[model samples]
Target: MLSDISGGLELRQADAVARALMTDDLLRAGRMIGQFCQGCGGAIGAVRLAMFPSTTRCSICAGSKLLAKGH
Candidate 1:
């Protein structure tokens, strides 16, 4: 399947990519209905949403979340 098409990619990498794609699709669908930040329940701006359709959080919350995770 995806691993074969990806030239024998590791199973874990393939799984991660598949999950990310699914999550991205779900987030995009949510935006189509009505956009909101999944992190802080804030309104997501149109420019930001357009820039990152799969984003689930506003910039402030996203930055904080990343910092919390030490990333």
Candidate 2:
């Protein structure tokens, strides 16, 4: 029983760490996306920006780039 409890605790701790790392990745992605848009002279919407937090540009910029590349 004690071992089981310890195992459960460890699992929870690992999950928490994973969630924190995911959040950090998201923030970094958002900053990069924002910078990309800035370079392209486009703007990201506040709501979408906040939601993604790590995206560099809004959907429009991404779509434009994709369309330009014929992708």
Candidate 3:
């Protein structure tokens, strides 16, 4: 859809933009919710939460999880 609208954009760029827009919508909808990190027991900041609204895990925990997934 975004690629169709953004005719000049590369597929990767369009995908990124589409993802960002969708994520922004998700964050706006979930802004009031205080997402907690299960691993560190830390509160995820608004900026981080806005960037990643679908997950309860904070960036630090998410990064470690990703690292572990590679193993």
User: Which structure among the candidates has the greatest TM-score?
Assistant: 1
Better of 1 and 2 by TM-score: 1
List all candidate RMSDs to the true structure. Answer: 10.1, 10.9, 10.5
TM-score of each: 0.44, 0.34, 0.42
lDDT of each model, Cα atoms only? 0.76, 0.66, 0.73
Compose the digit string of candidate 3's lDDT tens values, residues 2-61.
Answer: 564478855567787878899898887775557677767788878887787777777787
Q: List the residue pairs that clash in candidate 3.
A: none
lDDT of 3: 0.73
Better of 1 and 3 by TM-score: 1
lDDT of 2 by residue, 21-40 (tens): 88999989986665445436
Ranking by TM-score: 1, 3, 2
Task: Tell me, by lDDT, which candidate is best.
Answer: 1
Candidate 1 local Cα displacement, residue 65, angstroms: 4.3
After superposing all C-alphas onto the true structure, candidate 2 shows an RMSD in angstroms of 10.9
